[model samples]
Target: MNFTRINGLAFAFSAIKYIRYNQDFTKTTATKTTDPRPWLGLDGLVLALVCLLFLILATGDGSGNESDARLVLTTRRRRVQRRLRILSSVPSALIVFLLGLILCFIRDPTIFSDIKLGPSRFHVLKITWDDFKVGFVRGAVPQIPLSVLNSVIAVCKLSGDLFPGTELSATKVSVSVGVMNLVGCWFGAMPVCHGAGGLAGQYRFGGRSGLSVVFLGLGKLVLGLLFGNSFVRILSSFPVGILGVLLLFAGIELAMASRDMNSKEESFVMLVCAAVSLTGSSAALGFGCGIVLYLVLKLREMDFSGFPFFRSKSEPTAEDESLINP
Candidate 1:
């Protein structure tokens, strides 16, 4: 009908597509086991609640003492505002979780049905000198530089785009976290790094303050304690399409942030950077190419400025002005 109606219909269709895409249809021959976790049963309920909330929040008040013409206009404006608020207020995580739940229901997977926690082994306490030597020479020495560079770049790019003006020390924080994770690895913890994808995902999912990190750490702790053996299975069950959507949005947001580079030269450099990045899928290569292009352009500009023929005809050179005057 109208533009507003078309937009609303488009959004509705997109939501349906997301739900359909997440529906797992891989036929399994095994019998489905009953899930004992309280949270497991609440998936559909949560989705319904979220949808109901969205509908309620997105609907505007129609009651007014205005004429029929004014009422229609006012109603449309309120509906638009409500839609914006609903879109902005919904957290990305909720969408991901809903998608995962839908997939789980459709597949009826039982991959985690046999998970059970057992007693820890005592051999983990027996650390040998050879282990330390090997770790130092083989693991730490070669990986540290690359890890540090990745962390610094990720932090700088994310902070520059999403949290500008926030004072964040990339080196100090990266090193500190690296050291902590390194120590944790000695006791069988997985090697961890501050990855760009992780940072982007966090930002995409409504993580703005340091409290988000704290809450994440706390959630991990709780999960590890409550479902030690099942943690891997739980995470592995998430739909791939849902994760792709999250990453897609995160990349879009980061790319859109680069629009602030308004100067023509900077814009050209940015386009080069984007092209190289997309072509190679490497941030380091893209950055290097941008730097090289910028330098080449600068050198060419300097060389052209020095040539008399390239100079603007509106301004006379010192030699030409003196000759004319004489």
Candidate 2:
């Protein structure tokens, strides 16, 4: 349940910012992203187990001082400070979000109840909180944003899962989640996505607590209990443009980290793999892309050898391992 807790907290944090601070009509269109779905990975408990092993291996300490951990701590602390400095620019959004939380705590719920037609002839239906909770649904499949290489891997992974009690594929999961959501929203529940928006909102809001996320759940629950399907309709019907913008920002930022890290050949291979995935969904095409990319790289025919993991292997190593060891 740690995944649920962690992901929940993330969703909650973002919901606060999204519901309270983001007022612009085009709020959804301002960012882009691709948050992994909740169901894709091992359960939180499993992750904790893995983390425990990793931590045990990672820390060379039966005695903390006996290890080289001091240097690692210093490095971590410096990184945190550097990140804090970068975040100082978004004070207004933070302030507004906090204030909104306060107001929501004491204020009587604002309930909208009506239906009408706009001047543009678009149908307008006013709903309440009761309606919004029904909208919780799965996020979209990542096929649109991910490269062919990733897609092939995903498809293979999914194929493997299809045989038995395996984790569901995101593509198929998204459809099922979407179908259920469409039904729930159609009936009168609050809207929820697969978690991209929630993750984006969480990252935006600095929510790292269960309390933070439960508030979002509570808010939707309150709204759902009051207004029912109307609120879900309103949120679900929110302009795709807004979602597009937010997602776009998120995607660019997500990919940015891996952008530079690569084997020039690997990078080129990855790019072609991604590009092919971009153009076609054929089983043969995806396989051909991956295989061709690998073969070409091995032969040194198609070239674009990048640095390791996209980082320039050429960058001067700050720490000379030989010096330390000697």
Candidate 3:
């Protein structure tokens, strides 16, 4: 009878323990399954703060100042030699941008119709966890390469030509700025990156100093906050032809930078790369093809003596030998 009583108590305790364990498990599962906030939540804010701290720690000292100083000296020397004002084009480009904006507004009167003036109807962007994940996977991943190519590689190359003293790193710019933009994307911000065209435009408009970017950012922020809703519509009215013209000039400027390539072999490679780029409609494809072509040309020696055209009646002339050697 005592054994039976002890067994009953033991069973009862076991059952109680199981019940409590199950309840705790259920609570944990429920918490795990709860929907995450769509917008920049506490977690996102924490992540952003961590990133900011990392950047501050990583770039604590101005170790790059010596290079920048040398660049300034070189720039001064170039300016003195060339006798050209770097800021000369800024006014014209600014005027063109303003004119383009005005023309767009003039062309469309109903551009502001969609903008509601009341405080009650303000549109708020809803950014969910799903949105952030999808953006990171789909948008940001793909954009990194494109931004590095178009913004850093192309822009830096062009900048080097236009401002011989300037130096920029493609990797550093892409990693830091790209990551920040990706973080911003979680909060419903459009994915942003520096671009060659934008850089060229800024340069053309006399934006040699870092202050230019600061001023521009401030202007854009003020404008956006004041007329956030109508901004899209206003931009939509810009004349495509005018924009095309701007792009054309930027392209020309970039092309002109290629003049610095002194070697015939390098020039040939560049031409082939350009042709491949035009045909493939992708800079990455062209870059790959160029690398392959350059390697093949460098490694494998080709002899034209086997061809009938090379089997001349007489021995090769000095002129022919000079031409061949040259």
Candidate 4:
């Protein structure tokens, strides 16, 4: 099929994937429809709708072009935009989360009665050498390339786009990721990376500087120290449908990164890459396909008409050029 047709199909596939992921919260088991898990029930639908409504109300017009903060022509408008940015930066997602907790309590007054407060078990030296070896060989090896692509290269590109004069070097990002993961492994913390999607989400929500990340890190540390595993109880009772709505918005914000693909070829490749990554559940495979297609399209632009074999008799060939010159 032509690339254009392929691109359209790719977009459709991506859209379907996104919809299904969010819709799953509202759907029950296909194997046993008789099971009552709040799927498609009044509670699930109501929770989702209420959360959606609150999220929409909380995010009216957003922080107003945070990327263009320095380009504002008038002082009055700049002041207004700055105020909006500060207000919008209040973490509306957290507000929605708390609202969900309140709704959960209203529905089931004894939801948190079973939660026992205590210090969570520390995860120091939890992994053995053999387990590390196996996991590193099987999982880490395959994920390295994807991490480089998304965590370093894509992040650098997106940061440049979001903060025009900012310079977030790939080298620094790679080192930071490596160091963080190395230290985290000792404490059995989940491996972490600076993903482009996360950066985009931060930018979408009025996070303009490193200070925002610092604040976030501090907040997380404080929460971990204070609540520990006990907080999991509150998180567990939170409505899945509301979480789906939150993720749906995050996905949409991340998808906006593709808006920079202005050319038809780039857009086609991006869509195909995304579709493959989503449908196949392998970013590496999608990266390989995108690279191959990009090279092929680029090669197609070469002028074979200049070759002697491709020229008609009316056009001077390489041999005929010598004859004419003489």
Candidate 5:
């Protein structure tokens, strides 16, 4: 499968950062808020247990070789593969989500007290010059490069890798993301962007075509229409352990995409980027570093056989390699 090693690492780091945000150990307590404490906690252990159960369920079919095109399957084998595919199409996340709701209901029914169906809350236009300046500096400035790399570039690249014939352009994705935020912000929605991790997760879960996204959009629309603020209770009460399991699998699946790097230099670049992203908590920094490292490598490999300006035009280049292999 065609993949970018750096993109895979970015997905994994993003997942880890998201998972950490949800875990109890990462919470802001009165005293522990400022301290960098260990990540081990009761919730972490519970999450691990839930993850193990889900992992078993996910791999129970033991059909890892489904992607091995070299193997010619018998009719019976094909039947089994078809059956597994059908079963996999049934979203396991729904089951986990419902289970979490049930558990919450049983443990404390008061959590459902806020489940009154109604319209969603919307924000009135209240932007001031100061707010805009502060938001631009604190939020937009840092997010620009990250969004460009992860949302536009990474997503477009992954879409091509996952769907060979499908060609997604960064410009299209960028425009889509911008339009989405412009409309969504008025409805009090969080700023959103298309992400490589999200694309990888969808593909891992058997969402192969545009129809899958259409169905998902329809489902969300229905839910919003019917429940509105009521759904917030379900989300708030949902089991963190189960959520952790979902994120854990997503991160692993995304990380596995890096396996196709196949070259030491590519792997080295990816690892350096991932490490910096994780440690510095800045995707922009990692991306900048990766670009610099890639350029350095290319410079080292430049043909010095001729004078700098007289290099052979026929020499193989990285772009040519990617085009041939991709």
Candidate 6:
């Protein structure tokens, strides 16, 4: 099949994998569905929705404060246009998108289900709201206009002084990687969250996908050295529709890869999570849903002892024991 067709099919499957199931399954069922290959469509849909939401918010006409932002954007139209011009290029998207693609493909322990389909290792991290210290101290208070840019510049200068040589260390590599990841995550930058994907996928790390992420890092390094700002400027110009297409495909591939959550309960939960994520932020939605689910099960008089993540459910199992609610 053509790549587009494959992408669409994958997205559909992923949605199936991620949606809310509204019920639980027998232990046998969960085991039977753990392969994780059928959920690609869901991932594609989720990411596509994320990008689309951002584009709608950025481009849509809004109230006074927003109009003022647009006015500022228009006042700087040439600069924005210049940026858009560069972003529209194929190579730029390839370079940027490739960063994400490589991460998806090369991450350790495989974030997706199919071992043959992506990196040898994959990981999924759950960030709870309670994990934060919930305090603002010193110069760190959520965005205050141009302070972020200044801070970044300060770091850049410090980095140069700290290294003071042509050589790169693990720390330097991590610093550069982190900066790229942040840039990609914000202001239309992508391919920055390499973390487990790059590290686990690399040589002797039991990674099959390491080569892909390595190439991406290397590509960025080359761009930094050879093309530099001009190359970056060009990459910044890609259209929303094009990125939508890419995100759509990427999400599908990822969701399809997460086929292990195949129980009716898991699938339903995924759908609910995706919808919530699409409508709101994923973290908020995930946490809210988790709380509700916990409560609902408790209300139904289901013993917390049998449920996953409960204090009672984690004891070492005997050979005769199975993952049942009984």
The candidate maximizing lDDT is 5
lDDT of each candidate versus the true structure? 0.54, 0.40, 0.54, 0.66, 0.67, 0.38
At residue 167, give the lDDT of candidate 1.
Answer: 38
Instruction: Put down candidate 5 lDDT per residue, 202-228, tens digits, no spaces.
Output: 666667788988998898889888888
lDDT of 2 by residue, 1-326 (tens): 11122222333334323322323553476342223223212222233233324323322221122324445657777776555445433432334333333333233233233322232222435556654444223223333333222332333332232223543465664565557656665444444444433433343334435576788788766765665555544454342222332333333222321322345665565555455544534323544676766876577653445545556566445477556675
Quote each prediction's TM-score: 0.60, 0.34, 0.58, 0.72, 0.75, 0.34
- Whole-model lDDT for model 3 versus the true structure? 0.54
Best candidate per TM-score, number? Answer: 5
RMSD list, candidates in order: 11.3, 18.1, 25.6, 6.6, 8.0, 24.4
lDDT of 6 at 201: 16
Q: For residues 1-326, what per-residue lDDT tens digits would candidate 3 score against the true structure?
A: 11111222223333323222222223644222233222243223232334324323322221211233445557677665343332232254455556668766677877757665422333457778997699779876766655666766766666665567875776776686768775775455666776665665455445667898899999987777767756777777664434433444444434443345668777777777666665524556666677798889886666767789867678889999999999
Q: Over the stretch 1-326, how does candidate 1's per-residue lDDT look in tens digits?
A: 01111122223333333333443335363222232212123234344345434433432221112334545557787776566656556664665566675566456557546455643342344568998899889988766654654555545655666677873587776877778786776678767776544565466556778898899889777767776756566556665445434444444434433325667887788667656654524445666687799899998767575678887777778998899998
Better of 2 and 4 by lDDT: 4
Encode model 4's per-residue lDDT on 1-326: one tens digit a residue.
12222322333444333323333434565321223334354246555666667666556544353556457458888787677666665677777767777766666667568555555678678788899899899879988987887788877876776677785898999999999999988877788999776676666666778998998899877777777776666665566566666655555555554436668888788777767766745677877788898899988997787888977668578998899897
Name the weakest run of 10 consecutive residues (lDDT summed) in model 4.
1-10
Please give the ranking of all candidate structures by lDDT, highest first, separated by commas.
Answer: 5, 4, 1, 3, 2, 6
Model 2 TM-score, all chains together: 0.34
Model 4, which residues run further than 4 Å from truth?
Answer: 1-43, 61-91, 103-123, 303-326
In model 6, state the lDDT of residue 163.
Answer: 28
| Alpha-carbon runs more than 4 Å astray in model 5 | 1-51, 59-89, 121-123, 258-262, 303-326
Candidate 6 regions exceeding 4 Å error are 1-192, 195-208, 298-326
